[model samples]
Target: MLFDTHVHLNARQFFEDRDAVIQRAFDAGVSYMVVVGFDRETIPLAIEIAEQNETIYAAVGWHPVDAVDMTAEDLDWVEELAAHPKVVAIGEMGLDYHWDKSPKAIQKEVFRKQIRLAKKVNMPITIHNREATSDIIEILQQEDAKEVGGIMHCYNDAVDYVQACLDMNFYISLGGPVTFKNATMPKEVAASVPLDRLLVETDAPFLAPHPNRGKRNEPAYVKLVAEKIAELREMAFEEISEITTENAFTLFGIKRS
Candidate 1:
């Protein structure tokens, strides 16, 4: 069985055949999925999906890119949303300098506020760091994020950064990029990260693995990621699947059926 630790099923791209796509994932052995919401608009949709599907869970937060326009009321709304029964984590939050959608200062402030909310609610956070490793690490340290440990979704950082997150008790989640021919860094992190600290995800409808690259990704495609990790760490496919699934469950506090 597989547990996709991070996904965005609420995205508009899946509106056409979301039900069918979710069914496909289950049929393909994807036992559970943690659907992440990046903004206020997506949070309710995520909760709605989770409430309808037994295997779907929700993670809510404002993405760094979306933090530019967020106000005090937006933060208050997120705190209220975090109380949802199906909301498993407070995230898809962190720094993303690649797009520069929001100023660095605003992004950091938003990230810190969410961290505090996670602490208040006693829930883990799903982090999204991109091209802003130092700032991300600095803010996480400043906020003392270890209290509510979480996963670094779609991790694409250097060994040092991966180790830093590990030190802070964050799970390192590998996505489709691990299967890319030139993805040397993520491959190294995958091989080096302790089995207990590792998790796998598709980040679906995006980051499709090799052979499936350039195509729309889906939860079922997470098998390709497991296959790649198996090859990288020289482990059996079942072992990789089992360990990562357990790691994901441990992090999200979800029980496997």
Candidate 2:
């Protein structure tokens, strides 16, 4: 079995065939998944999806790219949802310098607020970093985020930053990029991250793996990610699947069912 630790079944792209996509994931041996919701529209849908499926869960947070739009009420709403039984973490939140829709300072402020919220609730966080690895690491350290460990979702940075994340109690999650022929950094990180602190995800409707690279990604494709990691580490595919599933369970505080 495999745990697709990060996914976005709530995204609009899946609206037409969400159920089928989910069925495919299970058919492909995906035992568990966490649907991440970063804004008002997606947050409720994420929890809704989780509520309908026993093994699916949700993560709620604000996206850094749209940092300018997050209001106090938004944070309050996210906090309220944090109490939901199926909601497991506090983010898909972090810095995203790739887009300039939101100023970097505002992004940092929103990121910090979400981290603080996670700590207040004693829940782990799932970060969304883009071209802001150093700032993300520095902020995590400054906030003492190790108190409630989190995930560096779809981490695509250099191995040099892995220790910084590990030191701050963050697991490194590799997505479709690891299977890309030219994605050297993710491959390096995949082979080097401590097995116990590694995870797999698809970030579906996005970054699909090699053979399916240009297509709409889905949770079912996380197996390809595990296969790539297993090949990179010279380990069996089943072993990678098992280890990553266990790692996801540990991080999200989910017990085997």
The per-model lDDT (C-alpha) reads: 0.90, 0.96
Cα RMSD to the true fold for all candidates: 1.0, 0.5
Clashing pairs in 2: none
User: Please, what are the lDDT tens digits per residue for candidate 1 over residues 1-257?
Assistant: 98898888998989999999999999988889999988777888999999999889999888999889788988888889888878889998999888977998889888999999899999998999888889888888889999888998888988878878988889999999999999999999989999999999999899999989998899999999999999999999899999999988888778776
Candidate 2 residue runs with Cα over 4 Å from true position: none
Candidate closest to the true structure, highest lDDT: 2
Which residue pairs does candidate 1 place in steric collision? none
Mind giving the per-residue lDDT tens digits that candidate 2 earns over 1-257?
Answer: 99999999999999999999999999999989999999889999999999999999999999999899999999999999999999999998999999999999999999999999999999999999999989998999999999998999999999999999998899999999999999999999999999999999999999999899999999999999999999999999999999999999999999999
- Return the lDDT, model 2, position 143: 92
